[model samples]
Target: MSFLQLLIIAIVQGVTEFLPISSSGHLILIPKLMDFPDQGPLIDVAVHVGTLAAIVSYFWRDVWGLARGGFASVGIGTAPAERRLFWYIMAGTVPAVLVGLFLKTGGYLEGFRSTTLVAINLIVYGVLLGIADRFGAQRKSFEELTLKDAVIVGLAQALALIPGTSRSGVTMTAARFLGYSRFESARFSFLLSIPAIAGAGLLAVLDLADASARMQSDAITAGALTFVAAILTMVFLMNFLKRASMMVFVVYRVAMGVALLLFFA
Candidate 1:
């Protein structure tokens, strides 16, 4: 890929990955719309690493707490609340991992890559997010998270395996419906992405053993650019949620979905 194409891909992946907008949907549409070459598994893995680093950096405190809690759960420390939160995150990741594996192994993942499906899901889930945000209670804090709620959110996240269902969007929607504030909801969603993104990057890496030197160089550049963009985006989103509703994202998703459908039609 040319530098311009690489730059655009990194920006798109970084910006959309954490937003309610669907990164996978946008990535799928990029080549189709712009006639750029497909960025293969190497790029995918690189971008995943970038976004994963962004999440980790943005949530370092929570990550550290989870680490201590995880060790403590096995009798090493004394972080009861942290231990509970750690397990809750683990519980929330199971459904998505299983469903993703099933889709990959069955060769069913590619079937959902069409723009039409992405467009439909964009509008559908966008509206659902709007509805949940507008009507659901938002008094609960992150500390109030429970196992049942985590599982429910996990199940919602599995739906994001579809092209435009948006892992972050669906998880936030589930949390909204369960009465979490928008900020807390987004926090949990982002934290839950750790294992999911790492698993995906590892799987993508399995296909990279034979990557050429040039490809490896490109991957590193892509990863670095994506990391920069992703960290900035994460900071913006976290701060935005502190004082704003999700209606802007809802409007954006709906508008983009409608435009895609019209253009494709």
Candidate 2:
């Protein structure tokens, strides 16, 4: 692919990966809309790794806590708060991984990339997110999250396997419905993303081992660009949601879905 293709792909992947907007949806539609060539296996691996790096970097303290907490939780009879959070993240990650594996094995994941399907999900899930945000209790913090909350959110995340059903968006929506504040919902969503993104990237990396030298070089360049973009976007989004409602994202999704229906469908 060309430099422009790499740049656009990197920006889209990095930004949308953390945002409530579906990264998969954008990755699917952007290329079709721009008539860009397919982003091969190497670039796919690069983008996933880059975004993964950004999230891990931004949340290093939490990541470290999760790591330590994981060890503690495994050995101890009952986990402390840190260890509990660690297990919660792990628990929250399971449903998505299982669903992803099933979809990949069935060859159904790629087939869901249709513009019409994405458009419907964008609109429907956008409204669902809005309803959850508006009516949700919004009283709880991350510390208040329970095992039930984490599992329910994980189950909601499984739905995100469908195109336009953003992993972050669905998880946050579920959290909101369970009474978590916007910032807390976002915090858990980002933290939960660690395993989910890493798992997906690891699978892609196995496929990328056979890439050409040129493709590998391009992947490195794209990875660097995506890493920078992901960091900036993650920082901005986390802080933005602290005070703002999720209506902005909801409106954007609906508008984009309508546009896709009009033009692409």
Poorest lDDT segment (10 consecutive residues) of candidate 2: 37-46
Per-model TM-score on C-alpha atoms: 0.96, 0.94
For residues 143-239, write the lDDT of model 1, one tens digit per residue: 7889999899999989999979888899999999999999999998988889988898888667566688778778878888999999999999989
Q: What TM-score does prediction 2 earn?
A: 0.94
By lDDT, the best candidate is 1
What is candidate 2's lDDT per residue for 41-112, written digit by digit as tens?
457657878998998899898788788788787785444888888888788889999998998898887688
lDDT at position 14, candidate 2? 93
Score candidate 2 by lDDT: 0.86
Over 4 Å off, model 2: 40-42, 74-79
List per-prediction Cα lDDT, in the order shown.
Answer: 0.90, 0.86
Candidate with the greatest TM-score versus the true structure: 1
